[model samples]
Target: MSSNDKLPQLAAALRFSVLAYAMAYGVSAHAASEAVELNTLSVQSSVIGTSEEKDVAKYPGNRTVLSQEQLKKTAATSIDGALQHVPGVKVQDETGTGVLPNVSVRGLSGSRSERAQFLMDGVPLTLAPYGHTGQSVFPATFNTLDRIDVVRGGAAVQYGPNNVGGVINLVTKPIPNQWETQISNRISAYEDSDNLMNNLYLRSGGWLSDDFGIQFSANTLNGDSYREHSDTDVTNFDIKADWLISDSQELQAFIQRYNSDMEMPGALSPTAYEADRQQSQRLNDDYEATATRWHVKYLQDLDWGNSAQLEVLTFGHHDTRNFVWGFNTAGGHWADPAQPSTDIRNSPREFNVYGVEPKLSMSFGSQDTLTQNLILGMRYVYEDVDYRLRQTNINTGAVTVPRDWGLKTDAVAAYVSDELGFMNGRLKVTPGVRFESIHMNFEDRNSGATDSNQINEVLPGITAAYNVTDEWVAYANAQKSLRAPQIAQVRGAGDEEGEVSWNYELGARFTKGQSSFNAALFQVDYKDQLQWQSATQTFANIGETRHQGIELSGRYATQNVPGLSLGLAYTYLDATSEAEGPNKGNELPYASKHQVSWDATYDFSGYLSTLSGFYYSDAYSDNANTVEEDATGATGKIPSYMVWNFNVSKELYQQNNTTLSVDFSVNNLLDEEYYFRGVDTSPVGRYPGLGRSYNVTANLTF
Candidate 1:
């Protein structure tokens, strides 16, 4: 096709790519329906007695799936806290309430989940990834998801964009044919802190001539948390409906709204931190974020056992934040900055996002012998963002708007994946390719600066697996990922380059009798990696970095003790900067070089008990590898610490498919105190960790 002809074709195919954005959401509904018996009206785990988790897990790739049952047992306060045991992920709890998350994969940057992909029910969740590349503002609770699927490897080639880190799909509640409802209440406290939460869910079907289903859910959390002056409140609501359009067609729609208001409390200086970790530096500053999103989808089931889908999504996101506090301008070295500076400002931003996509996926050949699965799709997405900041003069009591940034971006993406199975389906190979074209326009209102950048790239990946037996599998894969420059990084015809990486992995999975485990060895090398410097507020190609690691996780049931289970997960990583710059040879911050987690559980009759432990190795606090001797909170060297949690729950009653459950748990069981993250840009960067705490919850389901 000629350049002009291809351009139109690309635009036309964008819708399919948008459908791909949601990752077969309609199919998920179909699968959930089939898995749940119509007669059973309950809020049970949708993944129970199913191989979907194992099936989604590819050989030679890094993947982890958390089901509803696991979420219940953990009763973690934050989504990041629940995922702490998963390998290849680093989560820092900035707000104790899960309102503020700084997460990373492997050793990539974690400022706002910029290096990874975040999805909810297959739909993207961030404001405008290409425009700002941050997710620090959008945080969700763990109780709202039926499951969480994480994929990290070349096989992610089908998941476009920030596929550089991995893909995180937070699956929403499924629509079942039966009627169900659930109510949950929780209260928690520390020696000096308290929390409160409530959740309600309702689902029903068959009102529209036995061919439709609808579901509604609402949940809220509020608290005066472990940190002083750090209060948080969040509310979320969702609605889903599906209709059987015809014998061969179906329709589905979903809508969700979220709102959050949180206070930062500010990080403590080294001295003040050592004196007391519960003090607040910014007492009156707060932030608010809100979003409303909706989507419509249509699905067709072809007579040949193939399927097609079309989807459209629209949303608006807004954030208003006030930062009026003193912070260390120099790096964190003392209890408080020797020369502190107060920055008083109010910043507000908004995002208007829309997307459309259509996709065709098919499977052909004998079911037990040779089967081929293919998926083709494209998507067109547009985003408009407005940002402004107003600075206040304390002495003069005047407020002046000093800056404004306007960013508009249009993106078109197309992708195809083919999976071939052989030897009675024991062996499988999948190859995929994705094409992306992006055009971004930026206007600096204060400077009268206008510039535009357009870029495109093709990403490819391959994965192969062999099932040696019913209980064992071996796999290997190699793939390349690409990331375009952020809107702020590019100038009109500037020399800034995009980011790329090649990943290679080998792994195996095994299950037998009462034990199962997954192990893998992986290495990711980057070229022209992008790093955002807070000091200068700019992005630069940091040259090169290498991330290699060994991941192992397993669980075993004691042979003699029918109700006892033990679990363990360990990760060893060599993630270091090799760009021959100021950070050369220095290990990345946050993600520990050695991470380990273990849990022991006892499940007997209606009562269950679990004990979990977490450990991290010491790491550097800054790129310069600076180290301090004092136990000061701002020591350039991050100190290693271990913490534990204990939980026990009882099913007080169960009859007629109805049940009541009560749970009690303790976090930071020993009260060991330490910090996991630090901002090296200034002295006000040392954030104290949470102290010991306890919680109790009651859940009723019918």
Candidate 2:
């Protein structure tokens, strides 16, 4: 049967399931007066938890948490820099300010982070989660985030569609219990350049009443990259509120606005890069974007002897992005050399998404013996997108519209998981399943052509964890993941079927007084995987690919060396295509084989110092695995690179209720020279990485 035939059945089943769950649990709200105890719902419900050490021990899969203290020690000016310390993750930097995030997990394509699921405060961060997953514009800044949670496996049952790679949650700061205000500023200077960048951050929050609290945060950055014509301006503002409606109910809400404009220094040819890597040839290339988002969550405790809770969350966002490019009319490369533009192309995209999710959690039995915790949830989302392209002549001042289209997507997902614990909670097992139904429609405004497609999938997963000793735990998980074809693919001539894969992982975590270690072995078998083609600026399916790897990370505080700590993370990946094509047995693009990172920190009295670095092995830039560079500098073998960083901070002043501190950091301490191919708009030239940069920051709190 066709997917369209199943749509009605799927919709009816979902509606029935939702209604049944509501009818079974809705009565608890009226009987709240007989609740055993009062418990306030945590705002960070979607994340693992704030206590990293304890949370990691009980989780059934590999997890990494970068705490606020760790983020401060790294002193990274961008989110990508901080993510380098994580295992099984790769970052391709296009802009030093992290205006656009290109991050991948477990050998997935890092071009625009299309394969991974990105979340901010448990809400989707992409322009359109179901229509266009590419992160053309990232709305959050590094300083505004309180922490980061990287879950590499066992997330398929809770998060769907594009979760084959994993889930990355950027957690924002919460409202404090007491009134407080903070102000911070950072200044950055690059090597061989006089341009300076400044970042300012302000935040204030506190409880207005015993049952109500609110927080406000704002961040602004104005800076220039290492190259000329690479200036960037970004602003982000957010306000959040939490209300304790009653002893058994609570509410949380937030609204955010973000805007950015940046000039893109287009790529350069090999010869041009050799001559001067920091020169801009495409003067008219730039990007601009804006986003407005709001979210609300309500939690209610049932009167079923404090064994159940219900949560309802709703969110919506509107995003607009525009890219302007200048090209030569003649038959030559756009960045061959600095020249006046003959034609200009403008592409703008707009997206609006609204979603609502409701979840119910119930517990049975006792923890001392055998206990089971069941979770049932469902989500419905609607997305609308507008895409347009226009061209203008530089000399004649003539304008023309070439392409204009609209896309609409309706997606629904339902999931259920039950965790059973035995041996006094020493051994735990969880089995879960998720059902997804998606419907998409596309319309070409110019041609008046329309098309529609539907996709339905059922994904299942199982995970187990065993506590061998008080300080050690072992875990394993296996799951099936899926991602629907994007809007472009649905509109184009490519296959409309969704990409599916099976993922498996085995890991263990150990912690002993001031020491911790984690290791995992993972593998993924894909029936079909989607890859970005830079030349065509579209996605194509690569059949039958396999990715297997191992990740290791550890931290230690040495007793011999007082006030000193060390950390290390490493990964070895083997990602290959087994399809019956010319690219068979070839290594996937941007899939680095070996990655390593290490860090050391010393804290004494009122001073703290840190040294850190990361290394990435070489990988191909195209599916053909071309060894030699082309004239356009598009396809070639990316060379290996290693970079180091150092940071130090000191407490300058402290009073009864106020404190001041200063810190300085030097990124790329050795001034490494590196370049990337097939990145962003500069798909045909070498895009140079940032050189050695220095930052000075001052923070004050009262």
Largest lDDT belongs to which candidate?
2
**Per-model CA lDDT versus the true structure:** 0.68, 0.82
Q: Write model 1 residue lDDT over 92-155, tens digit each, in one string.
A: 6666766766778887877767787887766677667566667746745666778887777654
Please report the TM-score between candidate 2 and the true structure: 0.92
Best by TM-score: 2
Could you tell me which 10 consecutive residues in candidate 2 have the lowest summed lDDT? 35-44
> lDDT by residue for model 2 over 516-612, one digit each (tens)?
8999999999887665667875566767888999999999997898869899999999998887788999998889999999889998776799999
